[model samples]
Target chain A: MRLADLGERSGVPLATVKYYLREGLLPPGRRVNATQAEYDESHLRRLRLVRAMIQVGRIPVATVREVLAHVDDDSLGLTVRLGAALWALPHPAGEAPGAPAEAAGPSREAADDPHRAAADLLVDELLARLGWSAARELGALSPAHRALVATLATLHRLGYPLDADDLLPYARTMEQAAAHDLDRMEQLPTPREQTEYAVASAALFEPVLLNLRRLAQCEESNRRYGL
Target chain B: MRLADLGERSGVPLATVKYYLREGLLPPGRRVNATQAEYDESHLRRLRLVRAMIQVGRIPVATVREVLAHVDDDSLGLTVRLGAALWALPHPAGEAPGAPAEAAGPSREAADDPHRAAADLLVDELLARLGWSAARELGALSPAHRALVATLATLHRLGYPLDADDLLPYARTMEQAAAHDLDRMEQLPTPREQTEYAVASAALFEPVLLNLRRLAQCEESNRRYGL
Candidate 1:
């Protein structure tokens, strides 16, 4: 396959495929001659993954580069590699006062703040209730832990009350979803395939989970209000 | 309370409060005399909601206005009002080629497309598995349904295989989360409180659901790979 066929087969435009090649998102095909190079099945496969991340996941190219690099490094353990990809993917956090959404999450400098302490504690309690020691073992050190706490603190500041118990149901369900995800990914043939699956699934299926919740809420509202 | 006092109580800056007033996000305080007006608890409450949507939800001002109007219309039934709010909130959908994330959802112009048909039938199967006729009854017309279908379609186009059974567990759990949300809102005293709570909770707690999944994925990955 040539670059043109790679693009056509993958349903990506030729120019965009060229752009990915230039950005090193897709490695150059084997040099066939002065003005032409031949792509193989591997190039097509890589191009497909890159397109999924950029197009469906809306991931920035630099982050995609980091994710691809993490997946490429086989010296790391499976969990570590997968964790790197998850970390590289976007997760929302609380915003600073009047700050833009991009600059979210409360500062660590506010460790003495009661609101921060309370929110952080809520995450621990929720994790405990779900019996998730992997999350609890890391305590406030985990990025996801910090991010959840910051989001809770922001909710508190806005006069919306939240408790660990309130999140228990959602937490349990999210854990269930994660189990389903990992179980499915385990059947994949290779580490790279599993990591790619994890990264893409996290980014893409998030919307499925989110919109399903919304759609269900709609049904619930209709039931309650006689719509 | 006066304008300054209103801003103080809401934790919204005085400048931002004034800007909200100018932007029609907040109605003007009762006129006390020239250059003076009195604000009450209601004004304080509205300001809080406005700040939550802007700072936490990252919702645009125009969409907030639409949502607020939906809530404010006393003539509309409870479900209608709530549905309007849900519609106004952001939901991820499939992106068009070369399109930005903002312009998502497959265009209706392609009604005959097989990918669209398969993705949509997948949603119907998912709804049937959950016994959610409310979602099924609405069909292709519902934004959330369409959004989910479009999302699944995008996944298929990217070479990701998904089945209705794969989403059944997730949909069941998301329905549970919605039950939790609506039950909590049912306890609020007034329609205004309930509506405001629904809007705020939907925007703010979305992060909790999202990050919790990431954290749970971390735990699951660790369990499988032996972190």
Candidate 2:
């Protein structure tokens, strides 16, 4: 098929198709003449894959080009290249703050920036502290801790700055205060209801953080005014 | 407060602080003279917010600058600007192809990029198809639709190359096959076990997509060899 035909079939514009060709994101079609080129099913497949990486993965064009280059290299597995590229892209979900069990295994460093490295360490410290606090207060491997650990692991890799050390001290302090908060939140008396409350609380962690920040600011202002 | 002091407080290094200053992600403090500068708590807060935006939000420096500018504009409500900035960043959770309830209400043309507009339409179509499939098979307000909608909204705003008319048919086909596959997997007669399976399935969506590409390639080669 010619460029127009390919564009029609792919539902992309001819100009955009030409741009992709120029960018080397799309391979050159067989030349029929100075004004014409023939594309095939492989072109269609490649186009779809490019669209998926760009649209679904939200990868930058430069990075996408590098990924395509790596995938086309016969020495590398396309699957591995694709996975690495996908991993490099920012996740669509909100960032979590700790590494998950699946991510705990040996993996190549996805980033080399020193700031990111420092941030990762901080997140690790926060998780450790949270783990310790849970063990001390709730008797070890509490369902909340388990859930948080899993969530954190996923977020940590995705690049959330949550140092376990900094967070541990803060979490310990919050844990002590939060018990009272939880008691107030759950006016019900059953263990099952409490478990549900715990689940809901886990989901509301960000909002709780926001509220805490506001309260702390208010308290500081009150103290300044001798209120 | 020297560079080292700022570094220690922020958990970022002197070198990284220098980098942030160069990138305009951090402002320089009052000069203690030509060779040194003094830092303060405001710098510490800014550094932490920068780290959060870059590491957790995965926002590029240009986008981060825009957010920072908005945040610093005192006329704007801090909470509203922060929420908008967060909304603009890619979500860390994987795309929720199953969660339609999370979908943004209606589409608006904000930017003038034709490709972006087309991509938004495509995402909407994909989500609509996914929603229809989930309603038909899994019942109303399915988790999968909610997840997909949330993911699609983020992907759409990020200028992915999806066009609604192009992806709708493909999504419908994929949803049909996925529904069949999931039905077979759920045939193991235990209601309590189904919840566990659903949770596992939700977590493995990305891995499954990764493997599906591999499976398709393998099948293609097998067919070529008459296997």
Taken over the whole model, the C-alpha lDDT of each candidate is 0.80, 0.43
* Residue range with the least summed lDDT across 10 consecutive positions in model 2 chain A: A203-212
- lDDT tens digits, residues A108-201, model 2? 2325434334433443455444443323332212222223333344434323333443234334434433443344334646433333233222
Each candidate's chain B TM-score? 0.91, 0.42
Best model per lDDT: 1
lDDT of 2: 0.43
Off by over 4 Å in 2: A31-35, A51-62, A74-227, B1-227
Residue-level lDDT of model 2, residues B167-197, one tens digit each, is 4433433433334333533563542223222
* TM-score of model 1 vs. true structure: 0.92
Top candidate, metric DockQ: 1
